[model samples]
Target: MSTTPVEEFEVIIVGAGIAGCAAAKAFGTDGRKVLLLERDLSEPDRIVGELLQPGGINSLKSLGLEDCVEGIDGIPCYGYGVIRKGETVEIPYPIDPETEEQAVGKSFHHGRFIQNLRKAATHTENVTVRELTVNSLLREDDSDKVVGVSAQSKTNEYFRFYAPLTIVCDGLFSKFRKEFTTKTPDVRSNFVGFIIKDLELPLPNRGHVVLAQPSPILMYQISAHDTRVLVDVPGKLPSVSTGDLKAYLEETVGPELPESIRVKFIEALQTERLRSMPNGFLPPSANQSVGMILVGDAMNMRHPLTGGGMTVAFNDIVLLREFLSPENVPSFTDYETIAQQMNSFHWKRKNYCTAINVLAMALYRLFAANHDADLEVLQRGCFSYFQKGGDCVDGPVGLLSGLIQRPIVLIYHFFAVAFHAMYIEAKINGWSGAHLSFIMFFTVLYTACVTILPYLWSEAKY
Candidate 1:
């Protein structure tokens, strides 16, 4: 062991992913001495998990990195289009005229954005970037009081760093979680996809999540013209690799994409290894300790199926900014309470996310079943929505936009709109207007509930 000195900072951040990097940048620029640790030193690249919602966009604006969000070369996704069992509907982004332009988010090349964040963290005046592996978390007096972290850089050297607060932003499967008591994750429907270049088709600025004939499919044109396809490739058929890219494209993609572009995308896949995933999520966890904090993915996951993780992570930051006293941030007891409340926020979203995953996969399977009736059912449901300016997707979309964040209401509204669509579509397609006017009567009942329930609930609270 070389006799060196242990260094200390105001905050210590572990992990280099978006969550960790965001925390480091936030705390560092505020002039808090920060040390950011990452296991790998290489710059992050690749196109996995590229989707970003408006909440994520607002996160950047809060950090004064609005240019980083807008200037990046990502295709603008105005909203999401869902392919349902018997319906298809487009969920456009919900924006307020009141917020700054940067608060509005569009999809981007995630790898590029990561690089921009990396540069920001390392360049900040009060921040120190350390490349090393954490051996274990340090605790004081064994009473769930976290003191700091002990790590070893390569070359088998030992070093320790301490701070008033320790942050673990490590990704899902984070070893950091073991440092604190946390609930095991309940939901984990992972999503995996590949980045394709030179897509010949002029893809929509707005993305589409389709219940294609085979896998439930998610296709988007990212910040650049590069394309991403999220599909539940059969997990048993063996994980496809670059070598299998040609066969997979010929068999799976050729039929779905435009004939002219099918071969082009195949070629791009050959050049770029195409991949898929089973599911991805970071279950909500808390510090459960004194003088410790968990931020971003560390606190919760916005399942990739929903593409809401980044947005939720941003919200976590927002809550922290409001609750975390930048000037004389409170003691560990107070910090833990604030962090737990934030965790609860994402926990509610995760439940809805899991429900959406089941819903998406079910619809994808129904569409793939290719039953004519199913397609008609889906089409009619969609018609019912726009036919009456229905808010089928608005509830979830607006929540992610941060326009409406009351979790209980947000979750209730999604299911409410979905049930309403079902009733309307059923009425128009089959039920008799005279004999089954009961459906429309029930619709009135539903409308009454939707209107009065929220008020009644609020007054109850009052």
Candidate 2:
């Protein structure tokens, strides 16, 4: 067999989504050659990553990708409106008096966001974004250190590209991450996404979460006349072709939404074209290999209930840029040096990563609780807690928006909510025969075990 000469770049990044685009832009800005490969170069129109938290917006600004959200008809989201039963409470994102930064998020079409990232990445002189499907990983002998990738072009011609570092930004259903690590995604629930055009919401510039039967549903504006709705189904949903899914939505998810949004829900059902994605959770872990590292959903994932995925991915890119800046380590291919740098990167990222990742899953489990009495109270307690309008609201809102990085702070506020639930239960049932008290203790204990313990485990290990 005759061998072809290898084409070398400083870095080869697979999957040009948010993570890959950000990485390419950062490295390209630093004057490093970057090859960004994607199976489809046209814009994406998926259900996920349509909203950007305030923290994520700031991170994009820092990375010079702020223009990605502009001119896309994106709506500014001030905070979240929690609707339970028939009542609604709005919890605005925390405003810092010191910095005076706006407590706002942004919502737009997921495809537009991807297009923006691609534009920003290609704007840089050193990044070459190409449409290519990565066929397999190229390694050096049996060492398992990925040197590059063998990809097939659109024309079905095979080519080999070599680089010192290969970034697997292939996202949630990554095909390459498992070749190095053996962790299987812990699938929790499924999210079905749909869009309704020409709909108006009462809460003009805020995300609304409907706590209803079966599971929680999220509604927010993605454009002036369109609203995006996501229904969280407890498990794998039955296929729409079954002729029963629309009835299920009308029965369980439709009644929970407000009248204005409910009309749109029915309109969306006419199309019968809801896009579904599994909610997967994977703890952030360090890749011990020398030449390859994972980023974005390819590296770690959390429940999308809180919409913190983009914030975490943008922040990850920020930290990576800082640690591997041109002045710090000009050469990205130094195996030993890059390995040591990655170890430090893992430690420094624990703060925001642990907080956001754990918060998403915990909030989903609490909000999606169907028939558990304790969880029901906890859900009601959560809505009421946010209604108090002070530090009670600021604390958890800050954590949810990715502004607060301390996991201990999350612990304190979470337990406070649990105790508040106990208080509400006691007020309704009256603590007699120690029966109600026992349930309170057990409920709070269960909340702590699920929320706090997993957070500690991820933080301590990574």
How far out, in Å, is residue 24 in model 2? 0.4
**TM-score of candidate 2 against the unseen true structure:** 0.96
What is candidate 1's lDDT per residue for 103-199, written digit by digit as tens? 3457777777777777777887788988888877787774667777888878877778988788787866668665664444434233446666756
Residues 1-462 of candidate 2 have per-residue lDDT tens digits of 333467999999999998999999999988899999999998788998989998898899889999899999999999988888778888889877888865889999989989989988888998998888999889999788888999887777777999989988999999987875677679978898888887776677999889887689998899988888899987768678886767778887788777767877887888848778999888878869777889999889988999999999999999998887777777976778787788899888888888888888888878887887667888877777888889988888888898888878888888888888777777777775578667677866686567567756864775
Candidate 1 whole-model C-alpha lDDT, 0 to 1 = 0.59
Candidate 2 local Cα displacement, residue 151, angstroms = 0.9
Winning candidate number (TM-score): 2
In model 2, the number of clashes is 0
Clashing pairs in 2: none
